[model samples]
Target chain A: MSDTKPLVDVRDLKEYFPIHTGWGRTLPLKAVDGVSFTIKPGETLGLVGESGCGKTTVGRTLLHLYKPTGGEFYFDGELVTEKNMPSLRKQMQMVFQDPYSSLNPRMTVEDIIGEPLDVHHLYSGRAERREKILSLMETVGLNAEHATRYAHEFSGGQRQRIGIARALAVNPRFIVCDEPVSALDVSIQAQVVNMFEDLREKLGVAYLFIAHDLLIVHHISDRIAVMYLGRIVEIADANELNNNPIHPYSISLLSAVPIPDPRIARSKQRIIPEGEIPSPLHKPSGCAFRTRCPYATERCAAECPELTERSDGHLVACFNK
Target chain B: MSDTTPKKAPFSMQIDPALFEPATAEEKKQQEVMSESTTFLKDSMKKLMRNPLAVFSIVVLAFILIVIIVAPLVVPYGYSEILKYNGMKDKTAMNLAPFQYSANEQKYMAENGVTLFPHIFGTDELSRDYFIRVVYGTRVSLAVGFFASLIVLVIGVLYGSISGYCGGRVDLIMMRIVDVIYSLPDMLVIILLSVVLKELLDGSKGIIARLGTNMVSIFIVFGMLYWVGMARLVRGQILSVKENEYVLAAKSIGTSSPRIIRRHILPNCLSVIIITTALQIPSAIFTESFLSFIGLGVAAPMPSLGSLANAARQGMQSYPYKLMFPALMICLIVLALNLLGDGLRDALDPKLRK
Candidate 1:
């Protein structure tokens, strides 16, 4: 997998939002600061992080939905910029988190899915457009008879399917799934996750799946990168990270995943981190997790650590782990 | 007893071929439980139909519109023409009661073996047919109302959408301009424009000559001042609607900014726009009548509802019906429009849906 060129490569991305503070003052809120990673062709890179840790911001900035403060993004070894973003949009799409708000209420299912095709002028005629829309709906497991219905008439799971069909209209090669299943029921979540996996296999589409669910990420991702305070704290193979988490934050996060079996869950020890996650506006100096880390030291506070290879394919950002 | 016998052994493991067959087209159609497809406008119209008040208002408006169009064709007397008998001025026809005729008109009709059309609302102080004058007044008021609201709708939607979609500095500056416009006294603007345009449009032909300077200035004031309210409303709606996830979805698909505003944002703001435009009609009509009442409306010899009412005020003591005719017409039209606007608000608002 590593032998093939990376489909999406980022070399330090930054996004800062200027917030007004009255009296003609403006403060910069660093939403995503110097985050970097790469997704190989046909591989799923799961980005796991707590709320407000800039997981969604990274996905948005990569797609140019939000302009990057500073970064370089390469797709298929070609540099991406505002000039070529429109063409690149056809190759990259996004499935938003909320199903209800993502689909336009005023639009029918066919129009919603056919919108991307309309914008890009992908189809030849009305017949071809209808054919493309119905086939896309079928691919996302929606009934062809449901084409004319509004978004509000469908259930949550079905609405998400419509949203997915819309994202897949252009047959994108790389998709950013921003917590796609987080707003769904557990039963529906499994169905959606399985559909995503099946789509990846059939279409050979790479995905940057951002989710806070560790178990689901471990189940579907080839590589997982854990983020804390707008930075990637760890990156490793899914199983390697699950079995041997090196960063103090990653260890605590993995331990927090609920074990299904009561007998084994009682026997397992959960590592609870102390204090609260620091605010992105006023993040702690040096290491963001040092305030909550049990292995904090003078060196950890004096200098921030960069992600360095600790094992065969495991990377951790910590002085001692 | 024979039918009770087991068909093919209870709970047979063999699969039934019939069960695995694909659904036929008829069965597939039956599986779809949704009702017939409806567009946003059709859906809103359906809801509007369910409201009795809205339907009543629509009927009333339609009737008034038809009457205004047809009355002039049938009425024998022109709105501004003075009554004459045998090609000479008939002074006795002045201030005749509704359906009443002067002795001179009766004698002329009797002698000529021809019956003249009865004065439906009687002759006014100037001996013009009151019924025809009322009809013409309605026509002028309705036309002014429609054209003014249209002006407001076009200018307001454009300004508001641009101000809203472009946030921060652009929005701030544009909204400040709206605030300035909002603070200007509309009555004073109309009075000033009427005086100024009256001089500029003197002896001008075409639409200016037909509508008169006062009516033209009233429309100008409506275009300039009335739109600020609509602009503010549209701006507030767009501020909230542009934040929806669907708008972001549109941007991600590379839709142009104008397309986003037209297709995505504006449709969501339609309820507000429709309600405001409906309500705006009555106010525009009222403003025209008010200006005319104060002698700042359509010029003399051309009748408007307000001017008609103003002319009737002199005979209010002896001929109260003169004032009543135009006044009643204004009241009915404004009331119907107000009810329709309320009904539209109720019907179009999604939050009010059951």
Candidate 2:
């Protein structure tokens, strides 16, 4: 990563959803808790975690789609306050996971993609707007003629492409691509991912790519951040993190990724983490991962490990590491 | 991977396939919606055409409405006009079988095998034309159906949407009120109100005596009674739709509640509302007619199907024509409306599409 000003610098961002108990009473469930990351210019930062590990929540919170319970965010060397959200939104966009949904079924593809343009008042006239929409569709590998259609008729891959087109419509410099290919077929996944990469290369855009598939993330991400129960356990350069995972959870996760070469796969012994992930509502006293960590000692249970850099780029949060 | 790529095309030189390929799923869905809308309307008309019974009833009802509207123009005689009669010992002329007069009569001349002139549906015991009364009766039945349903439409949509969207405590409270109202005897309330109004008007003097308690006020009573069922139906639909994923997506996007309800929720529920409204009109029309038949409806001499039937009920043996005309009109109007409602239901249901 370059030692320059990052496009998005999120510091200890948190979002807690409340669970109502009986009449008018509630308790907080910490969906995202004290997680921080930064995306350098023209870099893809992949947030890899299993379902409900708060990866999606992180992406949403960073965009201010959901109100963060805590933390500060800096966009382009400027602090992102509530007052500047509208203007800041023009620079940031998101692509959701579900190809079947996300795009409004009721709205035509043209309207869906042109919505951001409308919100930011980008185009000069109707003709100009249509021209821009067609261009965006071309960029995302969608037919310009398909603009008049609704979303439900498209295949999963095509719908994701439309969603990608919508995200790119405002000419945003950064996009939060939340599991862009997870819902697609095995054959179509690579196509959509390649299209995304081509768009990034052509437009020089940054992305906070959220996905559960570590292999896909490793392939696309310049750097990777591993999350567990709403906390970032480890973050480092993609190859370094994959080759030499320090944290137990990260090591187990990397070990579980199937090697394409049969010899290496047969030689490797996978390290499965102990037990199920504890509920976020009643997290462990110290490290949230302690309950499932095989290397958990007295110190690991007594205090939470801070995310500290051990080398030039490798950051890990583990007492044993 | 190499096999998938074109041999001549280098990186950044491949042809775009999205432009040449068949239309995407989204376009096809839109086409289906457009076609289905056309098909829905076409199918409704086709179905209506196929049901001969429904078609016949509609024709009869339309004819009745036309006759009622044109009664003032066609029937020149006033309602209370007294027919001058020369002294005759036989009072049997008062209850004569419509077109028949005894051949024994000398002074009274016969015209077209009948002495009486222009009583197409014969006359009542009082010698007033039953045909004219039945013709004018259309105005009252139609007016009640139209105005009462209008009120129901407005009230039901607003109440149901608010209750459904707000949910939780607000929904519970509104629903309880509906329950309380529903549990009451609706027809009894209407009957009692009509009776009280009738008595109150009877004692009043001056201008009231001149216009003499206009029958149009009966619509207001019926309109109030019909809204509860509509409100309940709308509320149930809204409750189901409000929980749908699309609704959740709207909320997540930070779209305001009112706009979501108006633009999204309302359009989705439109089909249901239309079907319900069509069905409601017939029931409301029937209710008004029933009330009149029991003397709690439009006051005497107003010429509602109900009034004509009621008058005929008392003199059925003496004047069978009085009962037959109004009864046929009532059955015809109700049956036609019901067929239209059934046709509307099938047309509006999206799942019914081929």
Best by TM-score: 1
DockQ of each: 0.53, 0.19
lDDT of 2 by residue, B1-354 (tens): 346644544444456554575889998998645332233345556666666765775677677677777776877544534333464333443444555543433235543354445556655677555566666676677777777788889988888888888887999999899888788898898888777767767766776565445354465565566677888888888887775544544443334578778856776687678777867777777787788777777667676766777777888877677788778876777777776666555554434444
User: Please, what's the RMSD in Å of model 2?
Assistant: 6.9
On lDDT, the leading prediction is 1
Interface RMSD of 2: 4.8
User: Can you give the lDDT of residue B199 in candidate 1?
Assistant: 81
- Candidate 1: tens digits of C-alpha lDDT, residues A1-321: 678899999999999988888998988888898888989989999999999999999999999999999989999999999999999999999999999899887788999999999999999999999999999999999988789878888889999999999999998999999999999999999999999999999999999999999999998999999999899999999999999999989999998999866667899899989989888888888888899999999887888889999987688899988
TM-score against truth, every candidate: 0.92, 0.76
Indicate the fraction of true inter-chain contacts that candidate 2 also forms: 0.06
Fill in the DockQ of model 1.
Answer: 0.53
Overall lDDT per candidate, in order of appearance: 0.89, 0.76
- Tell me the lDDT of model 1 at A276: 92
